[model samples]
Target: MTKLISKTIALLILTSFSMLKSQSVKEILKQNGSFRKDTIFSIKSDSKETYLPVTIIKGKEKGPVFTIVAGIHGYEYPPIIAVQELLKEIEPENIKGSLIIIPIANVESFLKRVPFVNPLDQKNLNTAFPGLSNGTPTDQIAHLITKEIIPNSTIFLDIHGGDASEDLLPFVCYYNRKDTPENTKRAHELSVKLGIQYVVSYPYTLTSTEPAKYAFKEATQQGITALSIEAGKLGTVQKDNVDLIKTAVYNMLENSGNYAVKKSKTVNQKSTVLLNQQDYIRVPENGIFYSELKSGDKVKKNQILGYISDEFGNKKYDIVSQTTGIILYKVGTPPVNKGETLFCIGYNE
Candidate 1:
């Protein structure tokens, strides 16, 4: 009798342990301190051995579902750090909504320290949207994210930064001009909460072959409030930008009623360059670049804006502004080809 009782107890304990281990993330959502790390997709190849893991943190109360994705380019570290810190600080007990954080969306490229492009096919993961199940590896990954990861989201924040080729001033970017009022308002509110230097609003072609096919544009189409945030330069992590992103994330969560948190201090946008109807100046030839005026400088029509030169320092071509405007952006690299975008001019009127 004694042996039978001991055996029964052991069997019951083992069964309970097995049940706990095999519980799905959805089942665990019932618990107060629930947090699940799910492998959304897997990359299988000798050249790349990695998997994209998504961490889902559902708050106790019923509220909105916000999905924040980072490391789309793998080299943009500030946004990655920002989202990871948000996951760490989030208390499920106090949360009013579900928060999903995909810290390393491009795990393969992150391990290789390059942009998230397939080594075998050179296909950018971002461009593969509404993807196929049995297509290329990137397509499968994109499909998994679009189907399983993004659909349940009510709001999305896709973060990025300038890669190895360029440096980006901290900015908030949105692609809905005025067609979607709710989404545009939500994006603008988050940008204001972030207190970034620039809040740039633009539009996309809505093409499936574009690089941002699965980005904020897709989210907007699905009725998800989304914003694309660029923090700092790529490859290296900047601590100041990381802090800024963390604070902004927390503020957004609080404002969204996900947590009982303090509001971010209001920041007046006094030094902003409100750009609209901007024009791009194209380079006419391959040459070294020389700028007569800096970005944010005001100029009149027919002004000598900049020039292009050869390696021996002989001037190749002179660039003149076609309208009265402010210089918004200029390319830094030299030997720019003909028809290459050299700079952007923003008109005041």
Candidate 2:
């Protein structure tokens, strides 16, 4: 009789736990606490009919809140896959902290498979940051992400892939310049926990000054940890890379004490080149250009990088490197325009 009573109590406890687990992410959003959902901004135009969906997954267990944002440029689908796959693996019972995921930060851009170039205002969604309250549609989207999504986050991972016209090698980024002692240490620790092979420290460049920059930098300034990760290309979805990133993100949450998964391999920030000094070589003039060097090739100062010729091939201008470095990325598009970046070169030193 006593044994039967104990078994009944155990079953009751398990049933209660299962009931709690069945609560949807939406139900979690409506709860009162440090966690609540508010639309900090919105974009509604006649031509574009969609809303930028942001979810705040704030765990009531009193731990860190990490935000994962993607699809800022629409076509970057691998990160979206990563976020969705991650959501499936996380159990509310195991999560001690919060995880806010904006799988498609730019919903219209994702639907169109194009970067949100503000149709009416002529602005890129990415370039419009710290977005004003009364700004354009793109600006409002940026404002929404910044105001609603970023404030409560203790850590942020803004995942992206190459924009249109290029494919990227699987890599992760933690801008070295934005790191404080706390953030730098947090980034390094998270890098190890994620277990992605190539751990790079991106320096503050003009490229780093936009899009995720304001949120990442602001998160750091607020003593929060932030890292940006990029993999694959604009429209194409690399399934393997997506799976790898999903695993890494899961491992990170596990390490952060939010999930009960096995720990991942710890990686060193310095093991890879961790290029902090980087620059892009832009096309000097409009021409039919041919690049002799591919991505990841090393070049010396003044080396023959490529050649540009007119339509008839009558005259050609040789493009050479001004510095010795590794080619991190090269534009995949042809018939290049003057002032458009052709190659991203990073110095090891």
Candidate 3:
């Protein structure tokens, strides 16, 4: 999309949302495509404040409202950078509908360099969905997302990478269940069409009755077609991972017939399908771990993936895989505390 066309679309969006002023989700989504960025602000004690940075763009043509959320775990860097690149790459003329881009959802976590949880209130942002307005900082941010972002999106993606302690394989995950079979099918199709060879089906778990702690779960349970992507690893900004996410996302939006994106060339890759993630192995006790496997490695049931030893090396116990599958993600760093996730295994059989 050229600059002139882009500006025209922006004008259209601005004109459409001319009466928009409030921070209500409905009002925010109704506005024009002039590439507006808004901050969802939350006040803290002592008059201090934190905010979630969000960019809302509406194309001239209306189609699926595609949303991309990153930086939920602040220490996860690749996805954070990837979303920025996507922001630069997208042109309004090419996009058919609206775009909701969250470059960094956990602002304090990113600023404070915290992993997994928000540094301000010690809450996991990912687990704070349908958040409380009167709750902690993380909760406030999550609440804004649940209320302002997730519900309005037709096709949603909550992007992430391995946090500081993780070594992860790149894969996309979508939900499936008996009760919401239609929702599950739509989500599964989006995941498969995302162009990532490696994919996983979310184990049938979350229900409408449960609290929507996770962003992806929150979206999925609402009958929206949503999926989560894990591409980067260990809080590092790797270029391949960033490009992987950008390309996958771009193709996803384009293939949906919602975007008129024209690419210079096509990326060639092997095709892969969905695998079911069956186990999330956690550390039994605080210890130094020795991993015998890396991400994407295949394993058999009861296979010894690694071991944990006490500081003095006096006591040790093997961390074994309970299923025959691929090591989707594992604790990449040596330090392992009790209850921390050690491995998430996925399988085809």
Candidate 4:
């Protein structure tokens, strides 16, 4: 009996020590001044799961949380590369607030080189923000982000660029809602500090029934200061564009009080407020498309921008600008299909 009692006491002491070790591990995770990388997984459906690589760098001193996300459209390469580089270079000791970077938000789309939508559910991830848990795969991912990530962020940045089939000039976008005037101003200020050449303001409209589902739109609605930065072009990763995006991100870190870099004055950038009736020029019939006008070109109303022709060099139709504005993006490829968007024109006024 004595021997058995002694063995039981030994087992009890080991169990107590194990509990203490577990508690210590938890405490270490809760402490600041370390960088943590986690692969977060979300259930897309009954049999499918999607994963996102998240990097969290916490500073020694407590401050606000800044969230940066990229790769919403898989073919936008520069933003993804910039985010990856940021994750590698940021040091927890040099930061004041925490930095949360999601390098690839849509992993499957990125791996498959899908352009604008997720392959699993065929939904545009950008338009499915604050999504439903029981919805499609893209929707589920957005829902997980809204519930798990956005609430923790004091400021948010959604990085994007032209997809594989688009050519665009770099621009920054922010929501301008009358109800959230303070948040709107903050977002605009952040966009200016982002060091982009063009700032686009997306004002809220009551006539449209389409819900506010864009990533930055949802975040702004939640009173989070958010800006969307766009760069790169033609679905290709240019080194200069990648560096430009990286610099913008660093500028954002400095503006948000996360980094210790010297703050630069907000540069004078052109602000373009998109009119409600902006035109998306679409192809009337299938043919080969040829365009002389590139993105960022000033276009007058009813001006012929390009033409679609038959295989035998017969001109089928002429693509014209509907508004006196600038071309935000033009189709990068020569192939045309019926109803495909050929040009996106933003009004000058």
Instruction: Give the CA lDDT, 0 to 100, for residue 318 in model 3.
Output: 91
Q: What is candidate 3's lDDT per residue for 199-248, written digit by digit as tens? A: 89866676568887889888887777888999989888999998888877
- What C-alpha lDDT, on a 0 to 100 scale, does residue 272 get in candidate 4? 41
lDDT of 3: 0.80
Question: What's the distance in Å from true for residue 62, model 1?
Answer: 1.2
Error of 4 at 287 (Å): 3.1
By TM-score rank, best first, the candidates go 3, 4, 2, 1
**lDDT for 117 (candidate 3):** 92
Q: Candidate 4, residues 1-349: lDDT per residue as tens digits?
A: 9999986886575455334432221233366555654444444466554555566777877777888899989989999998888777777877886777778988879988998998888889998988888987788878867766777788889999889988887777877778778877877777777667677776666333444577777777677888888898888889877887888878878877888756343443555444333578888999999988888888998899989999999999988777888777878888888987888877635
Q: What is the number of residue pairs that collide in model 3?
A: 4
CA lDDT of each prediction against the hidden true structure: 0.68, 0.67, 0.80, 0.77
lDDT of 1 by residue, 112-230 (tens): 67754755456777777766666666666676667666677778888886554334556666766466687788877777666665667665455444434656666766667888777
Candidate 4, position 320, lDDT: 79
lDDT of 3 at 59: 77
Cα lDDT for residue 130, model 2? 66
Clashes (N, CA, C under 3 Å) per candidate: 0, 1, 4, 0
Among the numbered candidates, top lDDT falls to: 3
Off by over 4 Å in 1: 1-33, 36-40, 45-49, 116-120, 177-179, 204-214, 263-274, 278-349
Off by over 4 Å in 2: 1-41, 45-49, 116-122, 204-215, 263-271
Give the lowest summed-lDDT range of ten residues in model 4: 20-29
Off by over 4 Å in 4: 1-33, 206-210, 263-278, 310-313
Q: Compute the lDDT for candidate 4.
A: 0.77
TM-score of each: 0.74, 0.78, 0.89, 0.83
